[model samples]
Target: MLEPGLYEQTISRELKDELESEKDELVSELRKIDDAEAPKILAEYVAEVAESALARISESGKDSLENQIQLTNKMIGALDSPSDLVGDSHQLLYLVPKVMHQIRGKSERDTLRPETPMSQSSLFTGSRHEPSMGSELKKEIASADRIDMLVSFIKWPGLRIILPELREFSERGGKLRVITTSYIGATDVKAIDELSELPNAEVKVSYDTRGTRLHAKAYVFYRKTGFTTAYVGSSNLSNPAITSGLEWNVKVAQRELPDTMAKIRATFESYWESNDFEPYDKSQHDRFVEAVKRERGDKTPSDLVYFF
Candidate 1:
């Protein structure tokens, strides 16, 4: 018999196929309506389809076969439409072909039925996206227009990619506010300086000896219509962590920007108030070390040093 997991996938696919068929009918009906109402109808239909499709995918991800097929088909179908026509189409487009290659040449009845679908193992198999919640988070981030990145530890690799983008935005006179911790790198400061060359760009850094870990990672992007925000769980910013060793991060986005923006701004303000701010100075490293030693009442104990 097919493994229980693969059997579930088969059922998921079938369910998805049903959903797609329904969505197709809705679209067809909308086209025959008054042209004046076409935009509204199309928007409603696309939103409905995305919501329904995403819900089905999430619900059946680990439990059904027909849903899986439907998901695959819908993803492939989205690739045929305009990029912005469908929400988060990038992940769907990539997922379709990759999942298809996995089951090519395999008989659905033999691979997913109550008995036949389980007996065969000769066909291809693989998962297109990395197995994590990252895919979901990535989609949310890509949907936003403006993002505020919070930085504490100057993770070089994360900065390498993210910093330049910020610099460019600042250079081009886009509104951006940066609040960074004292434990930053020279390279990072240099990058910030480059960004400062732009007018109206505000960058602030705090050197704190009394504060606890500002140990949160997140980005909030704002737009005229909405905002997207994400919080990551792992050290995705550093080289050793992101490249060589294990790391994890999550991104969450919502249509409501005001609330997310306010929350992030409040949190950053807490850090800013707790720490002392000074002009960017390369010579302050030793002063920071001294402050830390003072906070520790001598050289910080080995156990505490690990945290530092």
Candidate 2:
């Protein structure tokens, strides 16, 4: 039995052959018409066939399937007969196999059935993306066009490891937005200052140094061609966090993931606007650096040191 709300149906070879025969007849009729509008009529016919074949189909929106059908038909029609196709037997006949193949392909695709589908994942443990943190984190970061990060702390050495790639990313007009905190001595002033100097980038910091409670660590990467990804968990913007540590981060994609990308974006924007945080600038950088220096002068508390 099929899982809940998931169904798969395969078009029989007989039905496909029948559709091919019908397409051939349609082409013959177009040739016999000898009318300028015959190509337009063929377009209408393809759309009609697709609508009827995928009558019960639906996708992203209510009319997504219908729109795909109409678009495919129009594309096929344009490619088949760009100009004065009527009475041209060669062009008319050329559309037969093309139309048949195109429509059949659409029918197979619009079924909303997986090619090698998984019904669900292991909810008790692990994540939607396989393997563990560091590797997947780097892979997703390299693929994205925009990087939005939120962590309570950031260290310059940590960012330096990825600095070369981030520079290339900035040169290509990739954007960077970060929201970190000065609550602990955990954050490095050099990290914030260096990141602020990059092109198309902004870094913000919260100065709530006493019991800040802003301990959310997430990296949301927005890619150009595919779904956005966000790695959310215990990892922070530090050397051990990105490279190696017993961090519990998991990778998630927009389409398959449960509104994770949207929530991350929203959360970051909200913190970005809040009064507790200010843009990481020269003055803020200097002030934070001085504060860290004094905090280090006395004795470094264990909390000031990095932890998992």
Candidate 3:
């Protein structure tokens, strides 16, 4: 019998009064609780209100209430456990970048081309545009877990150029194995002595200048990150050869040629274990000197022989 507008206003006022009463009851209950317990109760109520609001919005097809509720809960949970949230965030920060780097590296490797200037298997001609062997060697030594050098002879000038890099590598627990000989009396005794004095360096010398005939010149850098590379060509560990000389060395990557890398490693291990090349002994310096002098066909007295 009442007017339609009057009925609607009366019902709306009743609903508003009921909501106010409920809010007052909630406030009274919160006041009765301890300060520590009040926050938890209030938070639960807040989550419930948020869920209800989202549910109403979902009815209008704005968003999903369930998803919104879950998101809200997660946000609140993160606030509740701040330290755990921070720890999880930090873990994600580290893992995301690492995963991205791994993915990028794999992609690059899959599309890698050989013989390009930037390619891992590129031919190093010691050109002005190409990287110098000395610089490349320093770069390899800086990152290598282990380093192996096989040269017919090692000149003092060349060894000195990379001596600082070798020292730093050795100090960081990197193992260094060097194989050389007095084949042409070009290997300097001082260079060998300096190498032998490094913290984790082992030098092997073949005194059989005529029989050993060790003419190979290769440098292998072993990395724990699986980026191992070997330079095998005509470049010996001499200043001119590594720096300004027209040296031609082929860089071989383990990732690109596994079999070749395996052979290189096997051959090095065999030579390292052979009796022809003996471990350098500081006590036998004089014997080494005599062998070098003998190879050079010099009759100068051992005391007067100067190492260049």
Candidate 4:
């Protein structure tokens, strides 16, 4: 819908021909999706495509999009003929999605979020989550608008400290996505099962990350204060790791480290959409837990049960 040819032709006052070409492709897709599920599928497609499109735009492009939308709203306010705004100025993007969902025989809330390109100084002092041993991580979690964590394993006791805060965040419409491992005696299955039960949270498990190039720990928090914060280091999703463990993780601010954040987000998405990880399963989790325990029982203390 935003092909460069449209703008070029508009400048030449020959927009009709180029616009028809673009519409042809879109119309073909629309006709093929003319089923009972069309609305839902279209809504979902728009959300996913918009996310990718907006994120790929440069900082100046994002500013232009926001400015255009805002300017349109300001002009809209002066219109005395029709002042019945369906959605607020900030949520104008959701109106069409909402209508499509209603036509699809479903109701889906939560519009596609438009992210502001961020860049800020790195938040690491000699490879640590905070400057010292402060509660920077906890504060980050508490202050986030959304939380995305990927760890090798999750320990319930360690998760307990932040569980309350996470629950609160979820209740307030924040999302939590956790990707952890379920390798032989490496990650606890019970931990994975526990995390899958939280509100507004989903968990993905890599049953065996042995030779799959997995071992990376990162926590991405999209804050309401206009900054995207992510931590990349050696910490897992265990209590000791989150609380007092001496792990080395570096914090990257999107504004200062936009490329780093982009790469990190891209990497996480690759794993997330791959066969290496899947939705947390209970029966399979039980079996995996048993196998992990049996494996650990048969191993010596010095033996490495799990390795990245």
The candidate that wins on TM-score is 3
Cα RMSDs, all models: 16.3, 17.0, 24.9, 14.1
Candidate 1 runs further than 4 Å off: 1-128, 131-146, 183-199, 241-245, 256-262, 269-308
Worst 10 residues of 4 by lDDT: 4-13
Specify the poorest-scoring 10-residue window by lDDT in model 3. 86-95
Off by over 4 Å in 2: 1-132, 293-303, 306-308
Write the residue-wise lDDT of candidate 3 on 1-308 in tens digits.
12223221212355556646666344321124568766755655666666677677577665564555556557758678644432221211112357656766754433222223222476888898977888888777766789999998788889998899899999989999999998767788998999999999999999987679998999998877677889999877778888988888989988767779999999999999999999996986898898888887754435322321
Worst 10 residues of 1 by lDDT: 115-124
- lDDT comparison, 2 vs 4, better candidate: 2
lDDT of each: 0.44, 0.63, 0.75, 0.63
For the record, the alpha-carbon RMSD of candidate 3 to the native fold, in angstroms, is 24.9
- RMSD in Å for model 4: 14.1
What TM-score does candidate 1 reach? 0.42
lDDT of 1 by residue, 186-229 (tens): 12344445434544455555555345435555544454443334
Top candidate by lDDT: 3
Estimate TM-scores for all models. Answer: 0.42, 0.55, 0.60, 0.54
Which is superior by lDDT, 1 or 3?
3
Ranking by TM-score: 3, 2, 4, 1
RMSD from true fold, candidate 1 = 16.3
lDDT order, best first, reads 3, 2, 4, 1
Worst 10 residues of 2 by lDDT: 115-124
* Candidate 4 residue lDDT tens string, 1-308: 44432211111234445556677464422134558866666655555554565555434564766654554455446555345532443532323456566765332233122121235444333334334312455656655788888887566666776677677778878898888765546666666776777778888876554655467788898865557888888767665565556666677887666668889889888988988887875656776677567646766534742332
